[model samples]
Target chain A: MNGYAGKILRVNLTTGTFTKEPTPADVARDFIGGRGFGIYFLLKEVPKGADPLGPENKLIISSGPISGMMIPGGGKCDWTTKAPLTGGYAGASMGGHFTAEMRYAGLDSIILEGISPKPVYLFIDNDRIELRDASGLWGKATFEVEKQFKEKLGEEYQIATIGPGGENMVSYACINHDYGRQAGRGGVGAVMGSKKVKAIVLHGTKSIPVADMQAYRKAGMALYKACKDAEGLKEWIRYGTTTVVDWCNQVGALPTRNFSAGSFEGAEGIYGKTMREKIVITDKGCFGCPSPCGKYSRSKKYNSYVEGPEYETIGLMGSNLGIDDIEVVAQANLLCDDLGIDTISAGNSIGWAMECYQKGIFTKKDTDGLDLKFGNVEAIFTLIGKIARKEGFGVLLGEGVKRASKKIGQGTEKFAIHVKGMEQSAYATHNATAMLLAYMTCDVGAHHNRSWAITYDLQVGRDLVVPEKVARVIWLQNFRPMFDVIGGCRLQWVELSIDRDLYVPALEAITGIHRSWEDLEKVGDRIWNMTRMFWARENDGFGREWDLPPARFYEDAPTTGATKGQITKLEDVNRLLDMYYEQRGWDSNGLPTLETIENLGLEAVVA
Target chain B: MTASIRLSDSLKNLLGSEGLFTIEAGHSVREAIVSLGINPDLVAVVSVGDEMQSKDYLIQEGDTVRLLAVIGGG
Candidate 1:
């Protein structure tokens, strides 16, 4: 229990009581921590066919063994719930000072179960845990609530709150923390809203226990030094995820105009260098991160401050919506943060609306008389408010693009870009086969964080549907998310290309459990299959069709831009899935075979 | 033969300029990068005109090579 807080806190909002139980040793050994623990609890505690927003569902927040330690980028806290948007497994990785606070409060996981009859907030200060009335804080924006908490409870406390979006139960409403960092996907905030909880505030002063203090300290310092000495340290710290804007645009991976095109003509206006020169005020970071990717910006035009219009926002809100100005995008970012909605989903959903408007599927009467044009800034702002409040047309969009398109039924579903109800993140994978497949089969819907294979797609032939490409996606899916499972950020290794071997000593010293990258990836593989099983258990006939990308990638080729006349053949899409399933030891229908289940040691868990 | 070589912001420190580097063209983009004393490992994606090309892509006479550093994260 050296690296663990060793306690799982269970809060029953319905009864307004809490209990503490020791984290199982076997669970820690098998799952490791973070998302591993998250999936384990989601599968065991939340029963099959439970309504995602109902009292039967539970939200499990967890931290890993490496969390709260001196290791670099050890700030990620995994928030898992049955998704209201997709009705499948949802896990959102939140980064900030929250992870350390959770450990210091002597907790590995905090399970929020049963709905409260009235609005309240959970306060944790060391051993003292209480559910306090949050009547005043309930309807406030996330930033205002965070500011009020900081002023009222002191700066030592870290708070996670939701805005009107969550209160209104927007399917993709997100939990906001540390001003801008969030558990930013998969309707986790909606689940939090459904629980009638406003925020969870924490303040802890205890020291984190480690197995070998001296070795851990030395290894942590060495890791920091290595990060500082990395080749692109200055540039990586300066640009962060924004560095890829020009590259993504140049490579035709940038989503443009509802993904009808790949490259945007106005990409230069919203590129990282332009933002740095225009509005960036400071380089921000999460807990103990040497190479901080968070760019804090102030928009003079909108008179708004935000942490980022990082690459994803730049792609989705800027280019995808056809809004070229970085300041406008930053304002949009602030709006999403304040409204407490996932920007990726919001942008993608709005993009679908814009396309529908352009094609006359949606008329002025449908848009409430605001011209829903792609580049209309005022319309975008108003629609965001509407979506947050679930008003008028925003109600349909708040349901997400997949369901919205299905209800409309104007042959518009083909253009409603999403995979398994969760809208695809910023990458426009029209011709990039591997990336296309990554979005298709990502455990938590169309999110690209699990396996960002666009560069790999470009590297190994974008249009190639070879078995090697499938293997590469599978390998990345197994490797990348181990960072989340271990409660650390992947950017240190992924962006800086740091020697992953550097963490072996640090991890071994902290937890006193020696795990190679191979061992960790094996755990990642197990977590992957376990979540896949959760999806199967929850939804009837959840298999091959659930893993299919939007028809836009295969059916429609961009008539303009970098990917002109290029589209994945539908047959090739099926071929990629076939190869992926084969590589993953799943059957032709993409279900894990019994042999594969036993091979991964998931027989007992699934059974 | 001369080729237009554009370095990403991260690699601009090595080249000491944001403007394109007019380099003596080699057989491949990898060869051209090495000839300029830039570390090949640092370069993630190589582009010729509008398409992403492999590092070993043979450089044509009128090629404009854009080199982006491999620094990427979600």
Candidate 2:
């Protein structure tokens, strides 16, 4: 009764029916929620090697107990599906009101199954669930579509919608919520589009029941006090991730000019200090997050309200693609949000194309007469449109870097810097072996959120070949993502570095189930093993070979930047994996042994 | 002791000083903040450098500290 909404909303789009079933207590206890429920359902129900875009591929969006509670930054929702992009298990957690709304609506998860004959939108106002016609809303930008929906519906509803990129089934399409926030990776949006559902809206007025309201309130206030007390709180909010721009640039992680260099010459323009001075108008936040990382800005240069060119957008779309103008980057960020593509992958793919064009692999003939080169911001915008439209070379790029490179193999694969089909996230990992290991082993493919190890790499030796670093990455992989399982943001602990123990009382009070950090870590291990099993069963002979970093990080080092002559050797990579496998109690091939699975209680789910 | 404090964008207007300013020790961050002629209640946390510390931390000589304010959030 505490921490759970007690039911799940299952929408079979193929039948145009919405059904609510009481959430099984066993599943709640075993799987927890959010990513846990998602992975469990994905493994059990989705079936092995199912076509990711087909009706058999179900997309489960879920939240955990911590969501919507007054706890500091206790807002995250998990989007899990067999990835249309990677052809593997994908779970992307997002911020904003959707998770909180799910908690308030007395729903633990929203499971979308089968493809609809026509486009439709799922609308739920408390108990009233309906599928509405989505014909007119098919082509609008995510922001525009949401705006239109809010104008038609009321302010109370929160909309998670995709744009033309998703409708077109772009491999890296992301579902956009709260204007800027996203479940952004591995084509979750593409899967939704395949199912012919454009948006899911939830609005509810029911009060969430807490087991111990007094303790919950006290713990929640204490979290706020801790956040309020963080020294970097104000400075951090001022620039958000942009604060790291100068530091990253200085450290040679800026991803300049299609990652040919790590440092950008024009990086100064996009510095946190510069953004604050030039255009950052206000600070924004995710649900219940006291430290607002969202930099909602007004481009006086462009005269428009854009959510941000957050560090990822600034790195991938800006410096990665060789666009230095912060205004341009902000505009690009807005376009990606509106278009519904994951900005990081989109930028990476475009950067790849630009490099190809410059290297004589492509010509004006291949690029639709547009000279696609690094630093051409206008060309970048045009190519983004073309990719969403799936026109010309954009069609090749739309398939994602892996497939594109495979298809255009003429040494082009040499520069395709993605791992497990998903484009690499913001950080350029040439020298940082720990961060490289983090990216390599990340569940969702090359995303940095699961284990942000660059600081660790910097703190320790950057290129040190040691078991401790491997153990650290594994520890982080198990720890950081547990928050997603609980449907909460980890930034309260990650960025603010709060006393993680402070959350124990709040969690216990809210859920009436006392789970210490160790208990939660066990759940995390369970989820990790389950997902690994899913990936192994779904793929042919899934082994250590599949769990590898990009060829560029090994075969080629940057010819420019701070890590100009650096590369992670093949021996070190194998060593890292060997250590990781040993530490995780997995077999030589990276498969979790039956004993480990049974210990984590994942045997039932996997078997 | 000449303890320097950096002001965030919003705090800049409230501080009435454009740049860093010197402060004394022995008092809590809240007390020293009030002594600097800024509202104590308005200040949120007492982060010494990179790490967030309690208000009781002694501001050592030439220590550049920050006093963050709570902003409106979701």
Which pairs clash in model 2? Answer: A228-B45, A229-B45, A231-B47, A288-B74
- Per-residue lDDT, model 2, residue A112, is 99
Best by DockQ: 1
lDDT by residue for model 1 (A136-226), tens: 8888999999999999889999999999999999999999999999999999999999999999999887776789999999999999988
Count of clashes, each model: 0, 4
Q: What value does DockQ give for candidate 2? A: 0.06
Candidate 2, residue A238: how far the Cα is off, in Å: 0.8
Q: Once model 2 is optimally superposed onto the true structure by TM-score, how far is the C-alpha of residue B52 displaced, in angstroms?
A: 18
Clashing pairs in 1: none
lDDT of each: 0.89, 0.82
lDDT of 2 by residue, A186-214 (tens): 99999999998999988887776789988
Report the error of model 1 at residue A562, Å: 1.0
